[model samples]
Target chain A: MPKYLLIMRGTDESNAAMMAGIDEMIATTRQFIDEMVKAGVLLAAEGLDDPRQGVVVDFSAETPVVTDGPYGETKELFGGFFMLDVASKQEAVEWAKRVPVARGAKIEIRRVPGSDEVPQA
Target chain B: MGTVDVEAVWRIESARIVAALTRFTGDFCLAEDAAQEAVAEALVSWPVTAPVNPGGWLMATARRRAIDAIRRSVALRDRYPLLTADTPPASEPDPDRIDDDLLALMFISCHPVLSPESRVALTLRVVGGLSSEEIARALLVSVPTVQARITRGKKTIAAARIPFELPVADERRERVGGVLTVLYVIFTEGSTATSGDRLVRPGVAYEAIRLARTLAALLPDEPEVHGLLALCELTAARFPARTGPDGSPVLLEDQDRRLWDVSAVRRGLAALARASTRGLGPYGLQAMIAATHAAASSVETTDWERIVVLYEALGRVAPSPVVDLNRAVAVAMATGPERALAIVDELTVSGRLAGSHLVPTVRGELLARLGRRPEARAELELAARLCTNRRERSVLLQKAAGLG
Candidate 1:
């Protein structure tokens, strides 16, 4: 079973929509999670704290330049992620299609590389 | 040799053999299945032709089984080419790797990737050398459920690439907590079933004790491990008298003191002494509480004040609504029902334990002691309605009816 990380990114509009019906959003998300759990594909899922509580540390400068919260020019902010055990990237995307996020939000599916895949010395 | 002797030998050696195989193959499920195959072979051949070195024979047999399995499965061969690179060994597994292998096996069995239930089932199956049926009986789950959990647990560990080795010192501290929690949950389930017809399942409880002993041996300097062992020993010492002839629950106050296991009490005291070398952890504190209960000849003579103090410390260290409810019970014993009732009411107002039957049950007892009959009856009835365990529910109902 290859584990896939489903990263949820939210736009400003999506964030506003999420805040409007937070309870219903949470209920819908819980139902989708329950479905995945029953199917035995869901490994872990957790929502990130609000974007305002986050920080970005850019190391492109000689010394790292630390910026607080979301960047002023930010369009899509990574909001949360779910780790699922599935066969392929397509299967991972199939599961991601069920996420109950607002319309403007986007999900990026990526496989989590296992420790065994690392080149040994 | 008798079946008991064979089982005893297998239990003692299974973890070491499987651990070594897993390290060699880097496949947990294959190692466990090979170990099982070797044990099955032992059952057939051991009685007919007893080997001089039984443990070594089992190891070699299991190694061969692993090779045979890899050869049989194309998927496994492609995935674990390293395992099939060499021919099966004729000699025993390397003795030098036994200790580290055992420790790594413990870590792997209790890896954080698996759910708590999965960890318990896998640990008992691999480390404790229990069959799926035995685990199902111990946990009161269906055999299929246990099998599914074990399979999924192994798949999850392999999928997550959880390494088969002891973690670094800093990481070990956090990881060991998860291991200890699994052991504690197993002991608790065995001591007092969460929801079952029986109050105590000796087999499960005894298995937890055995696993704890192995863990304590492997990690001798860890105080919390010894603390957990001491707690299990002290609590299990009272198991002999925890039920009546008809198998009904015998409350601590009502139990016959003569039936207590004196040897277990002595062992618990020794382990507690070792745990006290450092400051008491949560398990150490709980062991102290159990030791206090064991020391008293009767419930009236039990040091309720000390228990109350212990619960206070426990509340600070491991704060939970259950702890508060327990502290209220201790207050009732140490002081008066009036003081206890006040504490219970405060807990109710906080709403931390709103839906649990324990809150109402304790409230009912305190109210009954304070001569508030109607309120006590209602509370006890509510507890009865909420309880799921048939025996416990019947007792609550009896108490409610008696209040009227």
Candidate 2:
């Protein structure tokens, strides 16, 4: 079976500086998506809402509290996501190499959890 | 009737037929010489028969002639298993087999071993089937220049002992990029001539476009090839509107969109769709950027912000000063002229584009937009002086005059 999702985050500071311009960021992302699709590796890809629009829900307590914008102290945040079907971790890694990320943005690769074991919102 | 005329016609058809004959005979020089001899025969016989299948006839005669030559030469007596064993296979080979030959020939003609000038000359000679004089006229260069480039290009290929066969898949990807780049460069030069008396060289541009389209068809699965074809089609669409009645350069903003070639645009869009299927690489990304402009009805309606983004992506994939300059232009249109000017200022200060007319021309535009007429006028004048293209220089002068 092919690995479905390879989660990635911007890992380098230089890459972060490169993304200073939003127009350039979007253009690069779209191009990456276009290439992935043509290669038959891309199922779907999307850039997330701005960090300010992101809402993190905490379910650790009885009552879940939601916080917005720069929600946590984690240096690496999910800026965008892509769902791909590739042969192995190596193939997924190869695709990751082509992503247009900021110089220092971290790309964390993780397998998508099955529905039964999905992380709760 | 003249020797050069015969040589010219032979050059046009030689590469393709030679490639096909090579596959048949499995001898490179023999295939080449036999093809040359067949052309000589055609020079005498064509005037009389003028056969419908000249290429086919040449292939047939060349195969037979190659066998005859090999038989007469003592040096090749031991290696005559394939040629002497059989009555040469029918000259009219399957089209599928010939496609491979043509593809290999195209790759060879546009090989990276040759310089850009040499690549273009060889491509025109071998693929576009153009004579040296024709290429000379089309490029506005001396015939001797074209002749010398082709001579050196062929000699280099021979010296390198480059196999005249289609590369394997892995190697194809790497090598194909060079071929595509050469064609793209040719099309760009013809479309917006770097330094020339005329604004456009339709013949050269058309030939490049034709070759690109052929390559795209030959390799349908290669996204970059389709992307290149899309870029050519989209860019060529504007040729009709890129100049005025007196052949003066028409700024993109002032061009009449209605005059654009709609069919070419449509074809470009279709090719872009194919390109998109494979995911955009540098050429595909650039084509997508061009498609953004082609999609808009007018300059104001163009998605400059998207273009800026595409250029940035292109920069990452293919880092070049030219891409950065273009991205800056897009930034100016998307954000503010001031921001664009700042970027241009940095680029200039860094000496990345020190002598390029683009730096001053872009700076002048931004300055003009910011209401700095005097500064803008001076920059435009500087740009005009730096520019060697008559059409572009005239446009810069007009902008300067308007500023005053």
lDDT of 1 at B177: 87
- Per-residue lDDT of model 2, residues B30-122, tens digit only: 665687678778778877666655545776788779888888878776767777665555444565676688788788888878888988988
TM-score for each predicted model, relative to the true structure: 0.73, 0.71
What lDDT is reached at residue A70 by model 2? Answer: 56
iRMS per model, in Å, is: 21.9, 22.0
Model 2 chain B weakest 10-residue run by lDDT: B1-10
Clash list (residue pairs), candidate 1? none
Candidate 2 has an lDDT of: 0.75
- Give the winner by TM-score: 1
Expressed as tens digits, the lDDT of each residue in B180-215 for candidate 1 is: 999998998989888988888766887787778777
